[model samples]
Target: MNHGIEKKARIVGLFLFIGIVTGIFSIAPAIDSTNYLTEVNTNSNQVITAAIFQFTMSLIYLGIAILLYPIVKRYSQSLSIGFLSFRVIAVSLSIVGTILMLSILTLSENYVDVSSNNLLEIETLGNILKSSRDYANHVFMILALCTGNVMLYLVFIKSNLIPKWISFWGITGAVLSIVASGLVLFREIDIITVEYMVLNAPTAILELVLGIWLMLKGFDKRILKADEYENPDSCTLGTIHNG
Candidate 1:
């Protein structure tokens, strides 16, 4: 692989790793618990840390899209653009979720101080915030991510940028992710439940493998050479012969 392509692959892989780690850490037990309204105040630091990690993960999501766009666009401009757009949407929703988490923490602080007469009202608002956060983080955000990942894997499959099996695995995982998100949206399953986690596990595992592959091996050298030959004048391919 050329220096440019190799460098991009490594960075993308690193971002994927960071994104996954942060995403996992971003789930604050206090805010995710059933009695979050009463628990968040006691675990304020945990909630804040989770929010920070979530924000970082959102940025990493955007970064991965931006880094991959140029390469994927060479194979299919429309798919690349679609992938980038969906990732942007996912990142935006993630940030919104993070904000909602902090909002819930604030509500928790108030819930602790409120009198018994207003406890019900505070609980009601807390529920609304919690639900909104769930939808933003788990439902809508996952849908967008799945959509983008499908597009990305499609490009990879067509271009042979990575192994065919890996690309197929990505597509399958994306489909599973979409199903999970749909179930959540329809109220058939709850967030953080065993069913939901199982549905998401494939995608999470795929990402982990894909990240390691990209970091270690980068794209398929044969495909890169083929692409370079087909588009000799392309800026991205111009350096293929050099490094």
Candidate 2:
């Protein structure tokens, strides 16, 4: 029984759960992505609210990779690195975009007092920035779930480091999340639609539940023992390697 690895699993779960939870808060008030002008006028403080949430979420997103690396590397070193890499790009884009979002507040503030003659230019620039942030969200989401999460869940499914059912749920959730993100990206569906939420619910709930399970129950020892027989020195799966 690798108590060390057990502890790692719990920590990974904790971060994953918190990351998702914070992600929700980051986008709170559910500011409309498309209706920027209205959002600007109505939610004047939205920039501050969004920046706070995005920053918190970005840190947690990176934390998830750091926590999961050791547990995941035990199964496949390359795959673990791939997972971390995707997360890095995803989190970096999100953080940078968050900083850019700060400008929206200034833009919004100006919108309140600007001359009517410049309204067109101000609205255009504001919309452009809003669109860029939305695009970044779409790109990072696809990378994080499709590339990073897919690899992570696939490793778990193959190695039995976690329960097959939980792993399968993760895989399914990843697929569903990608589908949800795709619809938003392509304009087939809006960002804050019920259909979108329903599609993404699987992955969101998956992380929350899996995180709690890992934190509370730890890994199923029988499965971990089985994995130990297969890979004696790898930590969890890919990231942790004992000497």
Candidate 3:
């Protein structure tokens, strides 16, 4: 283990999470208007600020993935690489959503400011962009976030590199996230529903603890060495069972 990178990974993971929370909530009250045209006309500055925050959050995610990859690869090389890919997809989707959001701003400036009712087609296009933004966000959170976490936590568990409790909590959260996303996708339940929050809260808390644990404790040398073997799983499971 590169002690330097380990320390950096934990710190980066912590800030990466903070940035995500801050970036998303920064514009919530000021710019998150339901009426898109009204939002564009009245709070354009806030809307732009919100988009910037979102873009920054996506960038932070990239950093998190890169920082964690080295640590995770020792556990499962394939999953470590897959983690990067999943996060890349998630980040790309987030950027796409940001683009759609800015496009709505463009629509408002070009058409809504001029004539809202005369051209039903323009209104339709704006609505489509808005819908696309929402869907992109959904896919990012559902497919990318859940899948990535599942992969990470499973490797952590298998390698015995982190506390089993943390890994289990994270795995539970990943499972719930999958279920919550399925509910939203199929049932069309609102994303803001209690169900989603309930599912996400555990993972959110787990991440905070994980960051702290990694910073203070780092990965166990014994487990890290244990993972050098091709069949770390059998050894890890046997230890757990004997314990």
| RMSD (Å) of each candidate, 1 decimal | 2.2, 3.1, 6.5
lDDT string for model 2 (1-243, tens) is: 377768877877778787776777677342455565556557756657767888888888888788778667767888889999988988888887786577766677788788899999988998787777777775455656467888887888777777889988988888888888777878898766799889988888888899898899877787777777786655344334442
Q: In candidate 3, which residue pairs get closer than 3 Å at backbone N, Cα or C atoms, i.e. clash?
A: none
Better of 2 and 3 by TM-score: 2
lDDT of 3 by residue, 85-184 (tens): 8888888988888888888887877765465465677778877887677677764555797798788878888878777988898889878777777776
Off by over 4 Å in 2: 28-30, 33-35, 41-46, 223-243
Clashing pairs in 2: 71-237, 72-237, 72-238, 73-237, 73-238, 73-239, 74-237, 74-238, 75-237, 75-238
Q: Give the best candidate by lDDT.
A: 1
Q: Which candidate, 1 or 2, would have the higher TM-score against the true structure?
A: 1
Q: How accurate is candidate 2 locally (lDDT)?
A: 0.76
Give the distance in Å from residue 219's predicted Cα in candidate 3 to where it truly belongs: 2.5
lDDT of 3: 0.71
As a whole number from 0 to 100, the lDDT of residue 16 in candidate 2 is 77
- Superposed by TM-score, candidate 1 places the C-alpha of residue 227 at a distance from the truth, in angstroms, of 1.3
